[model samples]
Target: MPPETPPRIFAPDRRAAVRRRMLNLQQAPDAPRYLLDDMIEDVVERLAFLRHRPQRALLVGDIHGSLQAALEATGAQVTTVEPALGFQEEAPYPFSGFDLVASLGTLDTVNDLPGALIHCRQALEPGGLFIASFPAAGSLPVLRSVMLAADADRPAARIHPLVDVRAGAQLLQRTGFTDPVADARHLAVAFRSFGREIADLRAQGLTNVLADAGPPLGKAALERAIDAFSAASKDGRTVERFEILTLSGWRR
Candidate 1:
């Protein structure tokens, strides 16, 4: 029998569109890059701590080009495959034999995450490293509460189901990665209003890309959501927390 088809939780086209839009916006002088910058810094720090120096590296989903520049500064030749160039995380990659592979802010949305992980592992030369970071479980609690209030009678799936650290470790081990490690970091950001939070999400290309996303909230529902969001604020500002899950492994 043929292999079973994976459930399509996210739309590839929508993902591509949002990522492309994000890349375009990243070119702007005032793009919101806190999340991306944080992830990049963490990855670089991990590389330094591990004492893993890559002669050739493959970087995925770096919209700002900062990560590539950092990798290059380490004397590693970096090759980037970004969504703006039609790179799909779930799809098979063409090139291989790299000492390091780093995927930032993209793997969480892939339908076939295990397959993607396998590909990342296979692309590495022996003993190569694989690192990825994305918003994971327990993220966006404030926005989630607002959305739930908005859909009072019928709460819709406004947020993507995220992977926790345990699952990340299991996925790495299942995909034949050795010495797998997974951890979470929380980032607290303050927003003056719900609309500003939404805007930040869009700027980071972290908006909903679910294939079966529900219809937009009606005026009354939107108002309720905004009000609920405001009600949860303190001193005219709401604090939202994002849990970034980082996964690392090495190919045997």
Candidate 2:
């Protein structure tokens, strides 16, 4: 029988190893959740421009866990790239000029939304279409209220640094895309319990706001949060509202 070999230990430092482990603990699954599917479906319904077979299409979206929608939006022949979260890569521009490029609710979370749009425009053919959806800065007041009540001494959560519709249109125009326009899609639903709402957010990759002020939540804080949310609920359920802004332009 051959001699057994010991496992290799490659970590250079204990602190570095601990940091990596913590990152792994924070890492979440890259799959869509139940209600998030409905949210994406609703967005797809509004994307009427995706009816035909463009010579080439580029799909850009910040679907941390909503990869299903991203996969469905891009065609089988289409070359896709996500550039963030798990699948990070710059797309090889597939055509001399792409016929269309789209980012559905992804740009808002990016460090440079305008830069991404400019990159998309440069990749497209003249007269090519650019379509995107992003949550407006004005979304989810009800949830914000609950967060405020629970964490009174703490700063409010900025879940996503979303762009307003006007600014989003300006970004598209600034990228040298023409006839930029913006529209809104408001999603409203009621959850029976606050826990369900939080679960949905987790599944959607919407809960990882990095600015929590307190230490890891203790039992009392959690109970207070639940109570705050329950009291905020209207009638029998808490109303969850998401205001999404859809924008489009043409490469001129």
Q: How do all models score by TM-score?
A: 0.98, 0.71
Q: How many backbone clashes does candidate 2 have?
A: 1
Residues 119-235, model 2: lDDT tens digits: 777787887776676567777777677666666687454354567777877877787878888877677868888788776665554553333323555576667778888887888
C-alpha positional error of residue 32 in candidate 2 after TM-score superposition, expressed in Å: 6.3
Q: What ranges in model 1 sit over 4 Å off?
A: none
The TM-score between candidate 2 and the true structure equals 0.71
Tell me the lDDT of model 2 at 189.
68
- List model 1 lDDT by residue over 131-223, tens digit each: 999999999999999999999999998899999999988998889999999999999999999999998998898999999998899999999
What residue runs in model 2 are displaced by over 4 Å at the alpha carbon?
Answer: 1-53, 62-76, 84-96, 156-158, 209-215
Question: How far off is model 2, as Cα RMSD?
Answer: 11.1
**Whole-model lDDT values for every prediction:** 0.91, 0.59
Model 1 gets an lDDT of: 0.91
Q: Lowest-lDDT window of 10 residues in candidate 1? A: 83-92
